[model samples]
Target: MMDAHRQNRLRALTTPVVLIAILLIFVLIVTATGDKSLARMAAQTLIRVIFVVGLWIFVGNSGVVSFGHAGFMAIGAYCSAWLTLRPQMKGMFLPDLPPWLASAEWPHLPATVVSGVLAALIALFVGAAILRLSGIAASIATFAFLAIVNTVYSNWEGVTGATSSVVGLDRYADEWVTLAWASVAVFVATLHANSASGLALRATREDEVAAAASGVNMYRHRLLSLVISGFFTGVSGVLLGHSLGVLNPNSFYLGITFITLAMLVVGGIGSLSGAVIGVLVLSVLIEGLVRFERGVDIGGASFALPSGAQEILIGIIMILVLIIRPSGLTGGRELRLPVLGWRVRHSKQEPQSTN
Candidate 1:
């Protein structure tokens, strides 16, 4: 007879375990195939897993839409570049950086840690000012934050290279590295979701007035979740910089934001399993379409999707998913291992109020 606490822990553990298993299989098959392109795609998918899970930590629990995470991501990427680039290169490329930054260099892991912490700190302050707002206004505020960050990063030549892409970053975030970090992201998100604050935040998400009346500190929980969310979001950005060996403000802006949010929504915003599954399904779909765009042969006949068809098709898929299953593909249920005798459970919905 397992204790209730122990049983709950086992259930929570299954989602991450299943995800790790899937990633292991992906890496093994790709490596065994000796296909470098497939290996690269696998690495990219792992990174997206990290990004989507990070968003889930904040958006799913708080039931708030955030368009501002990309700003923190940009901060993280540029910050990593400042720390990891050789002093000589920094001085040459980012000449206007502060003397200490221009003359300092650090390894990827340490730089990533520092970048996450800095982004979290920024979120703490920003959330303090904005998390008080509720509903659509809060969503609009986040969009404003993203716009402001983009404008500054796009024009600030001294630090972010303005519109030019910053290069020379070490390509250290390979498949294994991204896999490890993506695992960490899931662990962090699960732990947070199981914590007291996460529950209190979700309470507010269900009914703000009821939660506040019940003594939940809505503002505090929202701010804490935002800070935690910013941390992982920033780490993902550091990984992005290393993976691509460059940084561009525009790269972290609209395109990445839309795809990531789409993944989260398509996966079911209420479950961690949804976040992981969404990334895997969409990544594979997009990759397949990309290959088809290059051309495909079926039954000895050549076929190809036009350029940009992948984007258009993905958009259609997202719309159909939303129209057909608004609760998402997971129906808001978390994944569990059958060997554990645990069944996936959907989130309980609040009764609709006619008010």
Candidate 2:
């Protein structure tokens, strides 16, 4: 009986282990590929992965859907852009800046850290306010926050260049840099998920009233998750700015926010591995479909999709995923290396005998 129980436990561990191995192999293969454009796409995908993972830390662990992560991203992007862009040109561009603001030159690393910290601070305030609400109200409040942020970013010319896209940022983000940051974000999120505070956060997510009855500080946990998520999302925004070499208020608008949310939902809201898978699958599908349309010829003539076809396709896929598997592809499964051809862990118990 004990042996049988042990076998079942081992069997339960198999799935995640195998998944981890496969994921590692996939990463290695992509990194080794000699295609520069593909490499660049992978790098961009990594940045998106970071953003989605950040969302997962809050939405997945806390069961609170947030549409305002883009606001945090915008904060990070603008902060990093302002810090790293040529200080000499600030007078030409941001003419109204204070004398001190017009003459600050910041290196890359410090600028990125500062950007992340600022975003975290913003999230601390926003989360404290919105986390007090429950259910749909919380979700709606988050969406409203997104709209408010967009409006401010669009019209705030003194700091954000108003509706115009901010330009001339130093391009320092690459695949390796993005990957390093992504790894860090993933590690931090995973650690948080397993810690005592993470358990309390998960309890609050599972049942807020019950958790509160048990003396868990629900609001505090939610706020902490939001702050942590904001910091990483900010880092992703910095990477995005550097990657694109420009910053635009419109880039972090509703469309991008929804897409990132979709990525998290389709990946699985309760698991980190799900977030990574969702981003990989969506990014590949969108990019590949667009490329296919660009390359295909129909009836002896070249064919190409309209500029926004990718968005439409992604939307369709999201709808299908929601209808078919709302919990996401991995559900709550983690990606980990397998032993003896098995993945995932299962609790062991003795089987009931009919005799």
Candidate 3:
């Protein structure tokens, strides 16, 4: 009995273990190749992992599609810029700042954490009202939230630079730094998915009427998931800003919102492993398309795709995936060890037969 239980526990661990190992291997290969562009691509991929997994915490478990998360990301990116940028630079670009925020300069690490916390708090506040709705209504509400955020940031001349890009941020988010955060995101996501709230929220997803009958507080669970989701999504934003050494309101708009959603839907929004896998697959394809646009050298001639072909191609691929496998590439399942699962089932059968 104990042995069977141990096997089950080990089986439960296989998904995250495999995911983290995959990331470590990817980094090792990139480092061995010593390609700066590959490293940049890897860093961006990790950032997407963090953001998509954060989205998974809410959308995967609660079965709610959100278009507003990028808004939280915008908040975090700008918050990090406000905190980390030098006081003198802030004064130069953002002259109408409050004395405390204007004069302050913070280190990157703390700024990242605080940025996430601020985004989470905002999620909690907004989710209190938004999570009460269900289905398409809820999705629309989230989209509205994103629009509001974008508008505010675009017009907030004194604080967010009013459509102008905030520059001079330190480009400190390299591959290793993003890898650490991605690992943390996977860990936190796993922990949340296995929690009681996660389970209850999923129950609500499967059947809202039945779950409510079973005493599952859908609102609370959904709200909790959103808070957690907002945190990592916000952190991803900070990483993006630090990596590029720039921040702009437009960066966190519809383009990113749709692509991340496409990653989630394509990778299997119903499964955690799907989130990570989706990011890797799409990021690689996008990078390849970018290279093609830049003109790849063939045996004797340079071949290049037309600019903007990547988006159209990606959209077609997404449509094909949806039509072929609506549940996503992983079909909404975690990575599991078949042998361990068999052993566990066999062990239970053995005890029943002995009795």
Best lDDT among the predictions, by candidate number: 3
Model 2 residue 222 distance off true place after TM-score fit, in angstroms: 0.6
> What TM-score would candidate 3 get against the native?
0.95
Residue-level lDDT tens digits of model 1 in 72-169 = 88888899999999887777678899988898888778999999999999999899989989988999899899999899999988788899888899
Question: What digit string (tens of lDDT, one per residue) describes model 2 on residues 1-355?
Answer: 2355555445444433443444455556677887777777877888898899888889888887888899899999988877777776665556666666667778889999999999999999898889999778999998888889889888878777788777788777877788778877887887778767788999988888899999999888889889999999999999999998888888887878988888888888878888888988898898788887677877898878777788788888888988898789887787654452242232233346697
lDDT tens digits, residues 54-126, model 3?
A: 9999999998899999999998999998999999889877888899999889988999999999999999999
Residue 68 lDDT, candidate 1, scale 0-100: 88
- Clash number by candidate, in order: 0, 15, 0
Q: What order do candidates take by TM-score, descending?
A: 3, 1, 2
Model 2 off-target regions past 4 Å?
1-32, 297-308, 340-355
**lDDT of each prediction vs. the true structure?**
0.88, 0.81, 0.92
Total colliding residue pairs, candidate 2 = 15
lDDT, residue 16, model 2? 39
After best superposition, candidate 1 residue 118: deviation in angstroms?
Answer: 0.8
- Return the top candidate by TM-score: 3
